[model samples]
Target: MADEVSDAGTVRADAWIWSVRLTKTRSQAASACRAGHVRVNGERVKPAHAVKAGDEIRVFHAGRERVVVVSKIVRKRVGPPVAATCFVDNTPPPPPREFVAPVAVRDRGTGRPTKRDRREMERLQGLGGDGPTAR
Candidate 1:
């Protein structure tokens, strides 16, 4: 069942993605392929595209891109440990949260931001205008 590899030496791109736990569901994997968010060997592929071992897959989902090289092919969804062995993850680490711009938060019941407050919030977000008013 979960441990068995495909005897055909290849599987559908969408099925392989889900079986390897790259996406949450098989349907989501298919949708991603249809939306052109999945690529195989550097080319966009359909959901039914054949995926074999040693192929590189690039998927963009959940606001992040994942790049992995297929190490083993599985047709049925497997556990995390088994799924982990199916691919060689090549995705880079995400940027640190500290480097992200902080959102401006106002206390509950606070009225609309005053012009000065709006300007300050814009400055903090690096969206301030370059005109003299920005200084």
Candidate 2:
């Protein structure tokens, strides 16, 4: 409803993020802000920071960074469709899975990796041949 939108023209950073579904919960948004994972206009912001329309916000969450421009101000959590209208997402697309290098996973109960295993893993990770003794 129209009443759900903030008439004050600004809302708390965490509340806006949560209302727009940028984060799963308001607490998560607040935690991210407290941890220096949220920014407004390129400066780190606290959870209580006031966010107005047109402000640029960057949030690091769930292993990815999200960049969005505030488009509308909503004080209460809204549906996904409504939330989508609240911000203009400018995040870059994620890299393709094929572009990601495979991580070396050692089996459990293997204790520690042997020297050769370490070397091999390093080689697979493209970190080989350039060590203190390589010369």
Q: Please give each candidate's TM-score.
A: 0.88, 0.86
Tens-digit lDDT track for model 1 on 1-135?
Answer: 634764348899999999988899999999999999999999999999999989999999889999999998897889999889888999999999998879988898889998888887887788855678665
Query: Where is model 1 poorest over a 10-residue stretch in terms of lDDT?
Result: 1-10
Best by TM-score: 1
Clash numbers, per candidate: 0, 0
RMSD in Å for all candidates:
2.2, 2.7
Tens digit of lDDT per residue, candidate 2, span 1-135? 897764358899999999999899999999999999999999999999999999999999999999999988999999999888888999999999999998989999999998778887888899875689753
- Candidate 1: which stretches are off by over 4 Å? 1-3, 6-8, 129-135
Residue 67 error, candidate 1, Å: 0.7
* CA lDDT scores, all candidates in order: 0.90, 0.92
TM-score of 1: 0.88
C-alpha displacement of 8 in model 2, angstroms?
A: 6.4
> What's the C-alpha lDDT at position 60 in model 2?
100
